[model samples]
Target: MSDDEILMHEIDTQLPVADFSHSSPCSAANRVFVTLSGPNFRINNGFETDDMEKLYSGLSEKRSETKQNEFPLIYLIAPAETTFDQIRSAIRTAAKAGFADIFLVTKRTPASGNYLKHGLLLRLPTASGLSPPSIEPIFVRSDRDGSIFINTGPSQEALDHCREKRSLPKLNETLDNYAACARAGGFEPIAQIHIDSSATYQRAIDVMNAMQRCHIRHITFTDVTSTPHRTCQGMGKGKPGTPTQSPSAIPRPPQIVNPVKR
Candidate 1:
């Protein structure tokens, strides 16, 4: 059986991940998982998650919509490749679904595109490009409302980034660190987990179980791969390409605060 097969099969196998359902906010709400394809989409294909599982572009959205409302809104978008069409579809699905919050697990920053006009744009801080999530970010974001409610999970590319960087922290350690950050901030902060994709199902299971243990009931899953050219870096809402200030210019700013724009 393939890794994706194992994942779906394991979903029904009473794994440690499943047992944590009572602990999860979403599970308690009892939302059925659904996947779909529609004319609105660009490529009309699913994802690597599906492809790896040999279930490409095929999704089961069987649950009744009436039953779905009882649970909090969460959508996992795993685009098949890093193509603009796939990226656009993922964004459109989330928006059209009208999900209150979304958990996007993509290698590319969704914010780097205009896809996220619904909520606040928070660019998480990292130690290395692949370091475990930083507390500095959430603590800063916590002051805002709708505080920590995980609506998404990370994708293979995210985990791959961690692996390439060679700083994959222990699953428990990463969770503990996040828990501490959330507690200290006195608010639940939104964030994604970068589990090692090489670890495959085990890594995913560990992350899920960890979330349960931590009472993080909400999350999403997606991998945005725009397998094409960059038409716009975040569709005009792109983050700072270069630092706003040089060391020499930093001391002089009270209002200007580094007027440089790249």
Candidate 2:
């Protein structure tokens, strides 16, 4: 059988259960199917292990075998219980292994209660591309409670914006304003999103969609360790260490930082 058919067969037998109720049907010719099994990840149902070093090594060898400049799309089949943090780590690992594009698989229904006939695809942010040197990337963090923090570095104006609107519905506006500001400063609008470990996959997707709507297409995922601070806080007024402003006032455009240098 051809490679695609072989892949479909593997997917049918090994892909983990995921909620595809809100996803739309889609297909791609160049793709690899992966199943997230707890601490270990399975690639195309042929390899399974919890050792990240081994996983990266294997993937790198496979990548080297492919034609130059060709990166396969990763279709990750994750169980419904998979947390956003796990998904993000998987994607990061794939990126390190020389893969770029990734898709989260979803299915409308299970056929015969045994296998999935087809899957709905959610195109994740490309795992490879880096923001251009000329553009300063803004950082966005999603809290466990689904609140968004937009940091543009020490900007009170940005902090005020976040304080006023931190919900997903207002995410578009928040990103748009940042994009506009970046453009005004002669830089491309790129956002680096960091998802909390407790956040949901749906929340990550929502943030991604919001970034796209604001024309901030150059996106990347960042780990918590990379950021200067985990959570954004307001410079409180009055008594020492007292935050006169509401906790919501903490979201703001952080000072522009060069991601390439970080």
Candidate 3:
């Protein structure tokens, strides 16, 4: 099967069961992290025109609620060339709708395996050749044991859209509804990353460093985190420069306190 097909299948199998309802809601009272997956979908610049319009129009309504603290959406995709006007408009819509946070997923240094780093997620757009008008994106690393939760208000709305509910009249409206779900009854979102590759150790260290520099203050990897005994898509032998060792297989390199000679 094609990679997209596999990913779609996996997502289908992974999804939990739940009933749909306009009034009946889920939870969005807590903080969350959402990780997006699929075949580098984020980096692909030109989407079907219909899809792009549908996505943005949907985003507009969602943004309206974001200002009301009704729902929030976070992105997890590799950077790519994107139009500034479109991106800014989306952000504005999000702000107007009561949305708060928007995070990005960046490539691990030495790029290889399923390694991810948070805090540095924003840099990927630049790395990938796109820049938003003026927005800050939280970066998060995907390695070891990681999860992304999205329960703020529009949780149900997003879930419904993802499911492509037929009863919903307009695709654009779906975004706003989902934002409401996230804001109203937030649901937790998660995506685990564990792969055996030579560059794993270095990737982990880079992620940790980025986290520290960004002042994200609540990540841990000591006893609770370990390399899992499984493999994932796009996870095989790494490229050069990456130290060949799974995240848990080797010790992280020492951080340089000061490089310039006094």
TM-score of each: 0.28, 0.56, 0.23
Q: What are the per-residue Cα lDDT tens digits for candidate 2 across 1-262? A: 1111111111111111111122222224345667766678787768887776677676666566665444355676766445676675565456556554455543223442533332323323212222223555667777665667776347512222232232455566677788999989987676666677777655565666566556565544544453122111111122322212211111212222211100
In candidate 1 the C-alpha lDDT for residue 182 amounts to 81
Model 1, 1-262: lDDT tens digits are 1112111111111111101122113352433222323323212233323231123122222112324333333333332223333432333333223222223322224345643221211111111122222232211110011122222234211122242221223433545677677878785433333222223322233344445445543222222222211111111111222111111111111111111111
Of 2 and 3, the candidate ranking higher by lDDT: 2
Rank list by TM-score: 2, 1, 3
Cα lDDT listed for each candidate:
0.27, 0.48, 0.26
Best by TM-score: 2
In candidate 3, what are the lDDT values of residues 41-158, reduced to their tens digit?
Answer: 2212333222334444544443443333233434433322222223333323222223334333343333545533233211100011212212111212222222212222243122
Error of 1 at 46 (Å): 23
Ranked candidates (lDDT, high to low): 2, 1, 3
lDDT of 3: 0.26
TM-score of 3: 0.23
Candidate 2 ranges beyond 4 A from true positions: 1-30, 106-136, 152-167, 184-186, 224-262
Mind sharing the TM-score for model 2?
Answer: 0.56
